[model samples]
Target: MKITALETLRTDEFANVLWVRVHTDAGVIGLGETFYGAGAVEAHIHDTLAMRLLGRNPLHIEAIHREMLNLPMAQSSTGVEHRAASAIDIALWDVFGKICGQPVHQMLGGLCRDKQRIYNTCAGYRYVRSNNIKPVSNWNLEGNEGPYEDLVGFMTRADGVAESLLESGISAMKIWPFDPAAQENQGLYISAEQMKKAIEPFEKIRKAVGDRMEIMVEFHSLWNLPAAMQIARALEPYKPTWYEDPIRMNSPQALAEYAASTNVWVCASETLGTRYAYKEYLDRGAAHVVMADLCWTGGLTEGRKIAAMAETYHRPFAPHDCIGPVGFIAAIHASFSQPNTLIQESVRAFYTGWYNELVTTMPVIKDGYVYPMEGPGLGVELLPAVFERTDLTVRRSSL
Candidate 1:
């Protein structure tokens, strides 16, 4: 079916999320979402991408994906251009799945497995709720919303948080206690005191759950290479499952050095855009586990390619989903479709909290494993309340 209109929606409440709806001539609409910098992504889709997308065949996903990347600015980075293109690409796939009367995972190549293991990203209810994307400011750690205020739990009572996750059958949890030190020192160096304090959570987790809970230490690309290596050396004793984005993703050689220095797997990044950038990391043996945020890394189209490339290097793919509901669903589809998908990244805070408020359906996440989603397309839709919300702002570009 021909793409008739491209509609984008954003709400003042969810400032960092932008939702795109691809309206087709056959009256089937496909939904896609991208997180962070909603304003810029929205502007790119309507002001720039609308010209390339309108009246085109929505099912010709590869052609449209290539046309979307034709701009010089859209090359190999998870910037605004990639984010906008990613949303549209996901929407196009959604259209294809709906037209074929199959789920997006089936459209990608069907399920490799019936379920995938998941790791809980320990973020609080209101984490990254504001426009500020920085560490301390973006945390939104003001109030105790409910039982799963995990960001606070991990910081103050990590032992308790680990026990809680274990109780829920979640064997893996990702935490970033070193971010404060990175923010304070501008990622240059960590003092002895800072190092001691940052190591507390790991100590607590080990004391509480021992090896039962797999710990993924997230550095959030905040530290310099030397400092990152220092931190990695210190945490080696704890036997963390992985070190995620310990340093910036720009230098493959530097990252390879960091990886060579440590025994723990180095999960490269969700910041990278496409397989072209991932190839650099794989070629250099920098990243042991490949991570991509489907929403920003060109959606499922590029996401599957990245997964395959990682597979070639004997690496495992883990899809990132600390974003919006639609993007999370898309990641699940990618996770199940790829044969070498190691695990899925999820936030207990987001999934159990605000995610349900915006989406009509979500994957059945039970006992730390996410079961395959049912129905056509991404198997989820924006809730009716989201459309009717008073804070919502909708924009459209029609043929």
Candidate 2:
């Protein structure tokens, strides 16, 4: 079926997530999502990518994907142009799955596992919704069930947080207690006292849950090489499942050095754009677990390739999903289909909070593992209520 229309729908309520709908002449519409920078992504899709997509066969996903990236700007950077293409690529894949009457994961390869293990990235209901990422004080505009409920626990009551997650059958949880300190020190260095304070959460988790829980330390790519090495060595005793984005993502050499120095597995960056960027890291053994945010690092198309690269290097893959629901579903498809996928990153806040508000369905989480989403084409949709929002912006370009 020929592609007929491309539409971008966005709502500012949840960190400005942008949704794309690819419509075909056969009356099938596929949904896709990308988080952050809704305005810029919308412009790139409608004003630039629209002409290349309309009237083409929606089933020719790779050709259309390459056609969009053919723009000189898209090849050079993973900025707005590639982000727009990533959303469209996901939509096209969704359309392909619908046309074939199968789920996206089945199309990706077939299920490698019945259920994928998941790790909760412990974030507050409003963590990613704000602009200032650190200080934790910026999140004070909202209050959770208690101080231990949200971002506060990572700083004060990490043991309680660990206990809470374990009660829910989630054995692994990720926290970023070090990020605030990294922000304060400009990622250049941290005082001995600050380093000790950052270790408190892992210490508490170890004390409270013992070896029953797996904690992943998320550095958020906020530290320099020297600082990251020091922090990694300090946390070695806690035996976290992994250390996430300890240093910046752009340089493979620095990340390799950091990874080599630590016994902890360095779960490399989601901030990297595509498979090419990841190939460099995998080639250099820069990470032990390869992390890909389908929303940020191209969609399932590139995420699958990254997973393959990780497999070639004998590294496990974990799909990052701290953003919105659709991208989370997309990640689920890739995670279940890839044999190398070790785990998937999820957010308790988003999955239980705003994610339910906008989407028609969510993944089935049982005893800390997620089963493949059923139905077809990512197996989820934006609820009509999202369109009814007064703050929503809708734009469409037709063939």
Which of the numbered candidates is closest to the native, going by highest lDDT? 1
Q: What value does the lDDT take at residue 218 in candidate 1?
A: 92
lDDT against the true structure, per candidate, is 0.93, 0.85
lDDT of 1 by residue, 223-308 (tens): 99999999999999999999999888999999999999999999989999899999999999999999999898888889999999
State the weakest 10-residue window (summed lDDT) of model 1. Answer: 135-144
TM-score of 1: 0.99
Q: What is the C-alpha lDDT profile of model 2 across 1-399, one tens digit per residue?
A: 899999999876664589999999999999989877778999989998888889999999888877987777775345787778878988988998998899999999999999899988877777767544344554543667433344776678888988888888889988888877887888999998998888888888899889999988888788999999998899898998888898878899999999899888889877888888888888888888888888777777878988998898888989888777899999999999999999888887778787888999989998899989888888899999998999889999999
Poorly placed runs, candidate 2 (over 4 Å):
131-141, 145-148
TM-score of each: 0.99, 0.96
Top-scoring candidate (TM-score): 1
